[model samples]
Target: MWVRVTILGRCLTDGQLALYRIPRTKITYSNIKYDWGGWIMVGLESECGNGKRKSGGCQARCAADGATARVTAWTHTGIVVCASLALVIGAPARAGTDDAAGNAKAARAPVKPVTGRKKPAQAAAPATPPAQPGAAAPATVSRAWSAGPGTAPAPSAGGAVSPEVAKMIKFAAFDKLSMKGWITTVPPAAESIFQDPNGLRTALAEYGIGYVAYSTNTFTANMLNNAPPKPQTYQGQIPTTYSFSEVTVSYDLGRLGLTGGQLSVGTMLTGTTWEPLGPSGAKFANLYYFQSLMEDTVQLQAGVFYNAQNYLGLLVAASMATGPQALVPYELGLSRQGVPAPGANFMINLPNNFYNKAGVQRSISPDGADVEQQANPIGLGLSSPDAKALFIDEFGYKTFSSPAQGSVWVRAGGLYNTSPYFDFSAGRKTDTNWGFYAAADVQVSQISSAPYEAYQGYYVGGFYMTSDPNKNMYQNYYEGRVYGMGIIPGRPMDQTALIFGYTTLSKSALDFQAALTGIRPFGDYASVTVSNSFRLNPGVYLMLGTSYNVHPSATPRLKNSLNFMASLTTAF
Candidate 1:
C-alpha cells in the first residue's frame, strides 16, 4: 500500500494514497490505498531474496527542486495523548527524499528493518486537522479544511477523521475570580454599633478567631408609677435601671486540626432584676460550636444556642447591627433564659430560597435536677421545677428577594413548652403550654434605582399561647404586634422604631382578674412603643424609647401608664 504524505514541519497534517505501487522511479500518484495499514510514499525496490523482503535501503542528497523534498515513510506506531486535557499526536520521524512528485532527493536518517511477529494492522492516519483554536498559527499551517469531502482531510489512522469544522466560538477572560462581604459583621463604614470596637475583633476574625461583645444600659422612668393594677393584671412592671451585656467567642477549630465546625461560647455574665423589661440574665448564652453541616440545602447544628428567636435574633433585648428590633416576639426564653443549653438544631433549605428550622433541648437541667422555675408564672411560660421539661421549637421562612426591590420574608414559628404547669391537684400541676406565631419581615434598600425606601424594616406578627388559669396567670391567651424601623432621611446613622401590641386574656383569666380588682376589668390590653436610636459611631449608640400602656376597660385594672427608657450601648 503506497500513499503520499504532506510533511508540515515536524508534523504531517495531510495524507493521500496511490493504489498501484511505482518501482524506484520519479513519479507520483493520488489514488489513496487502504490495505497495507500504512501510506507508503516513495516505494523502494522489493529485494526478495528467497521469498523474503530484504532491507534494501535508499540514500539521497538535496536536489535543486524548489517545490518538495524527499519522503521517508514510518509505520504507524503508538499514539500518546496530549494538550491541556485535550489531544495531540507526535508524528514519527521520517528519513528519506520526500517531495510531491515522490522522488525528490534529500538527506535523512537510515531505515531500519521491521521485525517481530505480525500484529493486527490498523489503518494509518488520513486527513490533516486544523490548528487548535486559540493556538498561535505557525508561519506554515497545512491547507485549512472547512468540512466536506474535498475539504477536511479524511479520518486518521485512529479511523474517523477529527474533521476541522468551522465553529463560532465565544469565551471570556478575567484577571481574577474572587469576592468578599460580611466577614464577622458589617464593616465599620456601614455599621453604627460594634464596628470592630477594638482592632482586636477584626484582627481575630481575620485570623479565624471571631469574638464579639455587647453591653446595653437602660434607665426607665414612669410618668404614672403603678404596679400591676390587679393582682393578675399583666401590665407594665419595668424597673427603673437595668443593664445587660454579653460576650461571645467563636474559634474556628478547623485551624486547630478540628474540622467542619467552629467552637463558640457565650456567657450572659449577670442576670436581670425585672421580669418584663429585660436584663434578665441566664448565663452561658452559647456553649458549643458543632455546626456539622454547612451547605445551603441541608444542615445539622448541635451544641448550645440561645434556643429561640426571643433571646437569639430578636433585638428587643439586644440590638443587631443589621437592623432595629421591629418586632417583639413573645418572650419565649423560659427554660433557657438568655442562656444556652445542649441541643441540636436542624435546618432544611427549601425551594425559592425558603428554609425551616427545628430544635429541642432539655428545658434546663439535663438530669431533671433543677428546671428553672418561673418568677412570674405568666412571664416565664410554665417551666416547672418538679417535672422534666423539653423545649421544642420549629420555624420556617419563605422569602422574596431582589437587590433593587430589597427583600421580604414570611415566617411561621411554633413552640411546644411541653411541661406540666397546671395546678390540677393541690400538689400536682399537669397542664402543658405551647405557642405559635406567624410574621412578615420586610427590608428595602437603595442598592439599585428601585423606588424602595433606603434602610427600612417592618414586621407584624400574631401569637397565641395556651395559658393556665389555676396558675394565677393568663389562661388561653392571644396577642399581636406590628412594628417598623426606618432611617430618617439625613439623620446619619439614626433609626426609629414604632411598635403597637395588643393582648387579650381568656375569660377564665379575666374572671380571676375581675375578682382581684373588684370590677371585671375587660380582658383586653394594649400598648404602643416608640424608640429612636442614634448611632454616635460604630463603637457607641444611644437609644431613647417610650411605652404607653392601656389596660382592660374595667376599673383601673391598670391605669394608663407612660414609660420612658434610655439606653447607651457599645459593642466589640
Candidate 2:
C-alpha cells in the first residue's frame, strides 16, 4: 500500500519515507483464499471517500470477503468493526509489501486528490527573536551636554544641584582672596620727627622699617626720620633741638561689614636732639635733660573714614597732645630762625581721595602749637617771659596719577602760625607768624612698559616753608621761609639727589643796634645725595647713601653726611 503523512507543517511522499516491519493480520480475496496470518492489501488512499456504490456490488462483495477471510482493506472508508476493534485493542499495525512482479505496477499508482481544502502556502517564517534588556543604544558625540528641559537627564547616581547652589559655588571660587605684602622706600626729611633742641642726636637713621598686611582689610606702619643737622654759628645754636620721628599704624577695617566706615588709631613719640649746622656751629648743651623730652609727651589720634566705589574717599581725624606740657616753651624759643619751629602741636586733619586709581589726597590741620605752654611751662627753661601763645594752621591738597608713560604728583599747602605775646618786650616781640609751602613731584618712567629690571625713571620735588616775624623771647633771626628742590635719577644701583636750598633770617643786633638796624642775613645752602644698591644675588642686597651740605657762611664751607644699609630677603 502507498501512504502520505504530514510532519512539522510539511508533506512527505512515500519515496521520502522509511519502511518498518510489524505483525500482520489474516486476509481473504474474492473467491480466493490465502494464508490467514500474512495476507497483504494494496492501493490505499488517505482522503475520506464519497458515499457511492458500484452496479456489480463490488464494495459489498469486497467487504464480505474481507470479513470471511479476516483480512484488512486499507481505504478512505471506515474499517470493519472487529478489525478496528482489534486494532484499537492493541493489535500491531504494519505496512503491506508488493509482489516482486507487481511492485513496478504498484509504484505507478495515481495519488488521490485532497477533497475539502488545501494547506496554507507555507507557515510564516519563524518570528525574529526579541531584543535583550539593558542593551546600549546608538550614541552621538557632542561638545556640550544638552541643556533643554527634559532632554538630557542628570547622572542617576547623584541628585541635581539647584540653580542657586550652583551660582553660590561659582561666586565662592571667583571671590576668594588672600594676604599679600609690599615694600616702600622714603627719602630723608620726608617724615617729621619731633625732637628737643638741647638733646643728643638719636633721631637720625639711614633706613626705616615698614610692615604692611592686606587682604580684604589692610594695615600699615611706618617709622622714618632725617639725620640731625650740624651747627652753623656759635650763639645761634641751642643746647638741644627737637627732632621729629613719627610711627603711624593705620588699619582699614572696611572689610568687616561694619559699614560704619574705616577707623584708625595711632600714637607718635618724638624725641629731642641738639646738633649745630656745621663744623663752626656750637655744641649741644643739656643733652641729659633733652633726652626725656619725648618721654614726657604723648600724642593720641583717632579717625573715621568713608570710601565710595567711584575712587573717592573722605577721612576725619582729631589729635590731642598731653604729657609734661613743658615741651611747647622749648619749641617756641627755637623759632628764632629757619622754618616755623617744630613743637607739641594739636591738629585736626580732614583727608579726601585717600585711595583710588588717581591717588588724590587733600588735608587740613588746624593746629594749636602752644597748648602745653598755655597750661604749664615749668620744665622748659626760662621762667615766664611774657610769651604769647602760638598756633599753627595748615591746609594742603595732593594728587597722584599715571599719565600715558609716567606718573605725576602735585602738592600745594599753606602754613599760618600766631603767637599771643606780640609786643611783650620792645615791640620786637611781635607774635603772629604765617607762611606758605608747596611741592610738586613727577616720575619720568614709573609707568613704563619695559621690564622692572630694565626700568628707568627720575623724580623732581621741592618744598618752601616760611614764617612771618615773631618776637616771643630769645633770638628771632631765622623766622622767614626757606625753599629747596631735589632731583632724583637712575635705576636699581645708580641713584642720586642734587639739592639746591636757601634760608633767610630776620634782622638781629649784637648791641640792640650793633651800628646796624633792621639787618637781614641771607644764607645759601647746597646738598648732594648719592645712593646706590648692589644686588649680591636674588636674595641679598647692599645699599649705601650719603649727603653733603655746603654752607658758604661758615669757616668750613663743606658739611658731609652719610647713611649705609644692607639687608637679605628670601622667598619660598
Candidate 3:
C-alpha cells in the first residue's frame, strides 16, 4: 500500500503544494507540512532510509517567511519533519473528494455517511448544509493532536493522506457537519451511528451522487372514543400516527460529461428499525429515474409512484404541505382512499409553472402487505394487485402579485382517478367507485416586509366520488384550510394552522349502516385539524397537532371523537 512519487510539477495552489502525483517511485518522505500547503520533492533517492544519515540529498523545510522563500541545505542528511507538518497530518481534511477509486483494497471498514433525509414535509429537504461543494476549500486548522492522547494520530499502513487526499476524505466523511470527526482521536461524544446526513449529502452531490435519510416518530391517540376494530398500539388501541425512517440515493451520469444525455437513477426506501432496508407503510420503497432535457428546463420522472409531499399545499409551500395529499400514501389514487400511493407512475414538470402526472396502481390484500414479491433481477413487490386503478393530474401556477407588490400566489389543479378499492350493493363494485377532485390555493398574505419568511395563506377545494348510491364513502364534499407560515416576527421557524372540512356521506351509506348494524352511521359530518410546528433548529423540529370530529354520527349527531398527537422530527 505504498504511494509512488515523482514531483509532477509545482501545484498551483496559489503557491501551496498539498499533493503532487508522480508515477513510478516508492514511498519515502522526510518533511511534509499541510499547513499553508508546503512543497515536497520526489526522486528515487533517500538519505534517512533506516535512520542512518547519508551525505548527499535534499532537505525540506517550511520557508522561514512563509511561501515567499526557503532557507534550507540541499545536502542535509537527516529527514526534516516540520513541527507544523505534524499538526496537519494529525488533523484530517474536513471536506474534499471521496477516496480515490483505485485504493479499494486498503479501505478501512466503511465510514457511515448517511445523507438526504426526506423528513416528513418541508423537513424532508436535506439538513442544514455546512457549505456548498465548491466552497469546500482548504480550511484553517485551529487545533491539532499535539497532546492528551498517549498515541499520536497516524494514517493506516497505507500512509497518511496527503493534505489533498485528506481534504477529500474529510469532505465525504464530515464536511459541513455539526458533529465533527476527530482525526487525531475519537471524540468522546461520538456514540450514535447516525452522523450528519446533510454534510455527507453535500460531499456526495459534489461528485454527482445523491444521498438523503431521515427518521420520524408521530402519535395519534383518541382522547375519547368507543369503536370496534380499534387501532393497533401498545397503549391500548392508540394508533401510531407515523413512525418510520427513509433514505434516497442517486447519481447523475450526465455530469460525467462524456455521456451526451443527462440521466440520474435514484433509489428510495422507507422502513422500520427492525428492517431498515425494507419498505413499509404504503410500500414506497422503489427505484426511479430523472431526465433533464431542453437545457434543464423540462424534467421527467418515472418509476415507483409515490406522491411527493406537496400534491397540494394548504399551508406550507414545500414538501410538508398539510392535508391528505402529502405523505407517500398507500391508500391513495382515485379508487383508493384519501392518502398517497405507490405504483409505476410517470410525471413531468418545469419552471414554467406547468406540471402533469399520470400513473396506475393496483392494491394488494392485507395478507400480502408486509412481504415484497421480487421481480426479475432488481424489482420488489411487483406481484400483488387487489384493486386496479389509474390517476391523472395537471396544474398551473400564477402569481397575482409580487414580493414588492404584496405576495399572492394561486395554484389550481384537477385530478381524476378510476380506482376500485371497494364494491357496493346498488350501483358499482365498490363504495369508492370513482373519484374526481378540483382544488385551488391562495397564498393570501406573506409579509415580505418582515425580517424573515412570513406568510398567511388559505385554500378551498371540492371532491366527489361515486358509489352504489346506497353505499358511498363521500358523495360530494367541500373542504377549506387556513394556515400561516413563519408569521411570528422573529420566530420564523414556527408555523400555525387550522384546517376544517366536511365530508357528506351518501344517503345509501347511512341507510345501509342502519339496516346492518341497527344504528345510523355518520352522514354529512365535519372535522377540524389544528397544528403548531416549532423548529428547534433548522435540522430538528417538534410538532403538536390535534383533530376532532364535530358531528360524530348521522342520526345521533353527537360530538364523539377527539384525537391529539405530538411528534419529534429529525432530518439527517
Candidate 4:
C-alpha cells in the first residue's frame, strides 16, 4: 500500500510523520492493508465501491481521496479546539506581563500565546499563525490570539495621551513659574522665610493660587545747602523717610478652564515722615487687577492699578540710579508711581522683538503723596475735583538673550493729561499738558553664568523728556547712566550705578525764584549720583547713595546741595 497522508492539502515532512508515529508505507497493489492497535483495512476498492466493479487504478484513486478528506477534517478540528483553549487560559498572564513592564509599545504589537495564564471570561477566536502570501501552507500550530467581540480588552499600562490632557499638562508646567527671571538676582537662601512648612504653599501653587508681600523704606537727608534765601528755611535740613508696603494674592484662572487668565488683588500702605511733597499719612493704594495673555502675542489688563514703566520709561524704572538722575520728569497729573488709579492697558507683541502698548488711567491730584491720602484714600475716591483722564502710548523693541549674550531695550512714548496746570512763566492755569519721552538701555559688557545673574552685567542707558516750557517747571530733562552688576565677588546680586542729570528750568520758574531771592540762577540744574544696591539674603535688600546738585531750584532757593540717601527692602 502506498499511503500519502497530508493535513490541510499539504504533505507532512518526514519529521512530523515520525513524531505522530504514522507509518510511511508504499505498495504497488491497489489492495493493501495497514495494522495499528486494531487490524484496519485501507486501499480496499470493494468497500469504497458503489455496487460496481472498478479498475485497480480507479480503486486506488478513490481510496486515497477518501482517506485524505477524513484526515484533513479531523486534524483541523483538533487544532481549533487546542488553540482556543490556549488563548482562553493565557490571555490574563500575558496582560499582566505587559502591564508590569509598562511597555505600551509591546502591548500594541501582535499578541502571542504563552504557557501559564488565567482563562479569559469570553472565548477568543481560533489562533492564526503569521504567514507569507504565495508561500507553502502554514503549520497546524498557531501562536497569535485575538479576542472575540464579547471579550474585554486589556487596559494600557502606559499609552498615548489625549490632545486635551497634553495641553493642560503643558499649561500647568508654565503656571507655577519661579520668580528668578523677574529678580535681578536670586540670593543663596534655600527658601523664603514665608514658605509654608506644611507644603501647603507648593500645593496651592500647583493649583494656581499664590501670595506675595514686600516692603520698602527710603530715607533722604539734605546734607549741605549752598545758599539759603531764608535762614529759617535751612533750620534742620531734616531727613525725610518714605515707606511703602504691599501684599498681593494671585489666582490662575486656568484652573477654572480659562487659559492664560489671572486675577490679582493687592493693597499698598504708604507713609512719609516729613513733608516735602505730601499730605503724608498711611493710605491704601490701587492694586486689584485682571490680566489675560493671548497666545503669547497679546496681553490685556484692567482694574484699579498703575504701571508707569509699561507706558514710557524702562531704563528709569530698572536702573539702580537714585535721585534726580533716575527721574524721567513726566507730567505729575498722569498715573505716577505710588499713586495708583483705575486704568486699562494693552500690549501687542510683534515680529522680531518689536512691540506696541497703550493705556488710559484716571488722572489723580498732581501732589504725589496727597493722591493716596486726600484725593483717593482707598484708591476709589473721586472727591478730588481736579482729577482728569490720562492717555499714554508707546512703541518699543527689545532683545533678551542669554545672560552671557547681553540684552537691549529701547522705547519712545507720549502722554496727554487732561488736568489743568499753572503756566510757569504766565502763572495762568492751563487746560491740559502733554509731553514726549524716549529711553534706551544696552548691555555694555559680557555677563557671567550664574543663577542669580540675569541682568547682572555692565550697562549704559539714557533718557530724554521734553514739555512746553510755558506750562512745565522743567522744560527739558536729560539723564545718562552707567551700571555694573556683581562687581564684588561672592555678591552676584549686587549693583552699582553712576548717573548724571541735567534739567533746563522754565523762564517763569527762574524769574519767580529771582524775585524771591533778589538773584536769578545763571544756568540749567545738574546732578551727579552714585549708588550701590545689594541683597543681603533672598528677602532683604539695601541701597546707599549720595547725590550732588548744582543750581538746584525746584523747591527751596539753593545754588547747590548735597544729599545722601538709603533704602531697605524686604520680600516674601
Candidate 5:
C-alpha cells in the first residue's frame, strides 16, 4: 500500500506533502505512533520511542510546533484508508530505504509555500472578470482516483470502461492496480452510471485490448418546400430521426507475440424513423481486420473493411448538415462504413510528413441505390454478382500528429470502378467509370494551448471532385468550409462550422426528376450550412444546425428550402 501525507499549513493543489510505499516487515508500534505524531508534528524527533534511533518511519521536525499531519492510503483490497487505519500503516521518514543520511537530506528540503493567495485588498475584487450567466468553469474531475485532487486525466481519443474490469476481484496481485479513473468508487466523468453493468467492458484493457462505443442520433425537419406535387416528396416538411450506434473491439497483437500488429472489429445498429437515412440497418461497420506496422514507415491492413475508412479523412469537414458531401465523394462507388466490402490497404509513410495509400474493395451494385444495403446489411456476404472491383489511391502531406508545429493536410485521390453503366444523358452504355478529387485544410489561427485543445482553431478548406459525366448523374461537386473550436472564451470543448457546397446535375438526372414530379428539374443545386456543437459532459455532445438549399432538385417550382437539424452523440 502507498501512503500520501499532507501538511496542514501548506496548500498544495493536490494536497500532497509526501508519498511513501513501505513494506510490511519494517512496521512497528512505536514507529507507527511517532509517524502519526498525534495528527501533528510539534518538533524534531529526538528518539524513535522504541528507545532506538531508526532511520525509517516518520522523522521530521517542524519549523514551528503544533502543525497537523494527514495521511491517506490505497490498499490491496481497493479500500481507501480510514484516518485511524492510516496512522497504523505509518508514513516513512522519507523516500528510499531506512538511512540516516537520506533522512537528513530530506529534512533539509525546502518547501515553497504557495504565494498566489489573494491579500485582503486584492481579495475584495475579482482578479479576473467573471464569465456571463450560464458560462461554465473549466470542467474538473472530482473522483478520488482522478489524476489529482481536482484534475482530470488528459483527454483521450478513446472511450471508458467499468472499474471491475480493471482488476478481476479474485486476483490478489491485480487487485492493487492503479489506473486513472479506473479504481474510483464513483463513475468517471465520461460515463453514465448505467454503463458496463456486467463488468465485461474494460476487462481486457490491462492486457492491451481497447474498446469504444458510441451512439449518434440526429433529427431533421424541412421547414419549407417549394415544388410541384411529386410522386416522391422531397423530405417535405416532415420531421425524421436517424439513429446509429456502434461498438468496436481491438487487440494489440504484441500480447500474442506479434509486435506492431493490431486487430479490430466493429458492429453497428442503425435505423430511421421516417425518410431513408444513410445505411439504415444493422451491419458490421468493419469486420475483422488485422493491421501491421513496419518500422513506422510502412503499414498494411487486410480483411473486410471500407476504402473510405483508410483514405481522404478530414476533421474540419467531419460534421455537415446533410451527408458526407464535402468530405467523401460517395458518387464514385467506393466502399463505405456500415457497408464495407472486403479489401486491403497498403500505405507507405514517406519522409517530411508525406504518405501514399492504395486500396481495392469489392464494389457494390449501382443499379439501385439501396440494393447492396438491403441484400447485405450484415456486410459478410459477397457484393452483388453484377458489381465489380473498385480501386482507389491517395497521396497526402499532413502534420496532424505534430500539431504544435502547425496543422495542415493536403491530399488528392482517384477511384476507378470496374463496372458497366449507361450514360446519364446520352443513354449509351459504358464500361469506363472513374472520378478524381482534391482537398486541403489548414489551421489559420490558434485558440488554446496545444495540450488543452490541439484541433481548436480557425480552419479553412476546399474540395473539388469530378467524375465521368457521361455515366454519373452529378458531373462535378464543389465545397468550401470554415471550422472553429474552443473559440469561445471559456468553452474549450465547443465548436462552430460553416460550409458551402454546389453540385451540377446531368440532363438525364434532371429528366428523371422532371418525369417523377411532372415539372422540369432544377439545373443545379447549392447549399449553405451552419452548425454549433457543445460538449455537455465529458463524453456527450449536442449539435444544432440549419441549412438553406437553393434550387433544390426535387421541387423546382419553389426556388429554395430551409431545413433545421440537431443531433446528440454519446460515448462510452
Candidate 6:
C-alpha cells in the first residue's frame, strides 16, 4: 500500500503534522517542524477524548513558538492542525535540545510590546491559478490489462502502432480491399483529356503486325522497214497498277503465350494499263470510253501474327481470292508481213513512187493489221473481253518500330493462280502470272512532344513475276493482268520494274500531307505522281493528286500526258 498527504499551510521548524485513515488499525504521523518541513512517521496513536470528538494518545507538539503543526492518521491518529502558527508548550527554545534557557533568553529579548502589525494575514493559501487561456488541458491516461488466451498487446502513445494501423485492422476484419478510379490526364491543356480512345481502339484492332507494298517491271521491242528513204518507228507500252488496303481486328489471348498475335484478312485490287510506246504516243485503247484497266477484287484471308514489344512484329497469311484476272489479255499473237503488191487491175496508174516503194521491199507492216486479220480466224477475244480468275496469295511482313519515328519494314508475298486461265487471244493469258514483292519505309520527326507535329517518311519497292515471260504484255494490257504487272512497258516482253515514293506531314496554322511517287520501267516508260491531303477541320479533309506518264520511245514532243483528280473525305 502507498500513501499521500498534503497540508494547506506553512510550518515552522520543530512543528509536527499527522495523517490518519480510520478503521485500518494503523496510526501514522509526521513532524512538520524539521529542516525539510514535511511529513514524518510517528508511533501509532490511541483513540481518546470525547465520544464524538476524538484525540490522539500519541501527540506531537511544536518545538518552537509560532510554529504550525498538523497530523493525520493511517487509522484515526489525531486532530489535524492546519494553522499557520501555534504556541509551543514544553518545547525547546534554544533550537537545540535545551528548552528552558532558550525560552528565558527569548523572553528577555522580546519584552517590548508586540508591534501592532497584524501578522501578515497568513499568505492567502497558495493558490492554484486558474488555467491560462488556450493552454492544453492535461492528457488523460488510462491503464488496462488483459489476461486472456491469444489476446493482442495494448498500444502505447508515441509507439509504432499508429492510427493508420488501427484503420487497417478494422478494414481487414470487415471489408474487402479494392482499388477503382480514373487516372487524371497531365500537362493540363485544352486537349489534355482528348485521349482519342478511338485511335487506341483502331491501333488495338490492328494487333501488332502491319503491311508493305511492292512492285517492279520492264519493257522491250524492235521494228524494221526495208524500203529506201522509208519512215519507220518502234512503239511499245506497259502499265502496271496495284492497290492494297487491309484492316484487321485482333484480340490477344495472353494465356497462350501469344500476346502479340492476331488474325487478319484484307482485299487487294491490281490493274495495269498498257499501250504502244511510239511517236504517236501510247493511249489507253478504252480510256476514251472511260474504261480503265481497272479491276476491283476482294480477298478473304486469316493468319496468326506475333509482335514483341513495339520494336518488331511479323505476320503470316494465306488468302483465297476471286476477281478480275490478275494477268491480262488471255491470248497473244505475233506476226511479220511484207507490203502488199501493187494492184495490177487498177484502171489508172498511180504515182511512180508508190509503185517503187511497194515493189523494192518485203517489209513488216508497222500496224500488223494483217496479223489481226489472220488472228480473227481463231475466234479468241482480243483486248476487249471480260473474265474473272481465282487464286491464292501468301503474304507476310516484319515491322521495326512505331510509325511516329524512323521505322523500317520488310514485306514479301506471292500470288498463285489455281486455274488454267491464261489464253492471250482470249484475254486470259495474263491471268496465269505470279510474282514476289518487297518494300521499305522510314520516318523522321522534329518534335517528340505535342502541340507542333511534323514528320517525313519515304518508301521504295520492287516486284518480279516468276512465270510471265512476256512482261510488257501485262503492262500494255493492265485490266487483263490484275496480280502480276509492276508498270506499263514501252515494248513487249520486258520483265522487271521499280517504284519509289516519299511523304511529308506538317502542322502550322493548318495541317497538310504531301507525297510523291515515281514508277520506272527498266528501259522504257517512266511516270511521276503527286498526292496531297489537307485538314479543313477536326474531322474533314481534302485530297488532290495527279500523275504524268512519259515514254522515251514515244515522240519527244508528246512524251508527257496528265491525269488528275480531287476528293473530299469526312470522319465520324
On lDDT, the candidate that comes out on top is 5
Tens-digit lDDT track for model 6 on 1-572? Answer: 11112222223334542322221111111111111122221222232222221222234455454454443312111111111111011111222211223221111111222111111101011001010000010000000000001112222221223333232222211111111000100010011122224444223323332211111111211112111221211221222121211122223322244322223222212122221110111111110000001110111111111000001011001000100111121111111110111010101112321110000111112123233224222212132122222222223332221212322333333333322333333433333333333322222222221101111122233322223333222222110001111112321111111221111111110111111113222233343434333334332333333434443222212333343423333222
TM-score of 3: 0.52
Each model's number of backbone clashes?
A: 20, 36, 23, 1, 0, 55
Report clash pairs, candidate 4: 1-27
Query: RMSD per prediction, one decimal?
Result: 25.8, 47.3, 16.9, 28.6, 14.2, 44.9
Cα error, candidate 6, residue 373 (Å):
31
The lDDT values for all models are: 0.36, 0.22, 0.34, 0.46, 0.48, 0.20
Judge candidate 3 against the unseen true structure and give its global Cα lDDT, from 0 to 1: 0.34
Better model by TM-score: candidate 1 vs candidate 2: 1
- Quality of model 5 by C-alpha lDDT: 0.48
Please give, for residues 180-243, the per-residue lDDT of candidate 5 as tens digits: 1110121222243224436443355456555656676767666764444443233333565667
Off by over 4 Å in 2: 1-263, 267-403, 421-428, 445-447, 450-456, 470-495, 508-546, 552-572
After best superposition, candidate 2 residue 145: deviation in angstroms?
50
Q: Encode model 3's per-residue lDDT on 117-159: one tens digit a residue.
A: 1111000110010100000000101011111111122233223
Best by TM-score: 5
Q: Candidate 4 regions off by >4 Å?
A: 1-193, 196-200, 203-207, 224-236, 277-279, 314-330, 367-372, 449-455, 512-523
lDDT tens per residue, model 4, 1-572: 11222222211232121012112221111111111111111111111223231111112222232133222111100011111121111111111111223322221222222222111223222211111000000010011112112222222222222333232222222223221111012111122344443655455666666665667676766677445434322212446566667665677676687766677766777665544333344444444445446444777777766555345543243221122222333344554445567777878889987988888777765434444456576665553656677788889887652322456778888878787777666666777778888978777764544211334567788878877666666667787888766556776556677877777767876786677787775547677877776666555667777777665554554546676767776765
Give the 10-residue window scoring lowest on summed lDDT in candidate 6.
139-148
How much does candidate 5 score in TM-score?
Answer: 0.64
> For every model shown, what is its TM-score relative to the native structure?
0.53, 0.33, 0.52, 0.62, 0.64, 0.26
**lDDT score at residue 89, model 3, on the 0-100 scale:** 25
Q: How close is candidate 4 to the true structure, as a TM-score?
A: 0.62
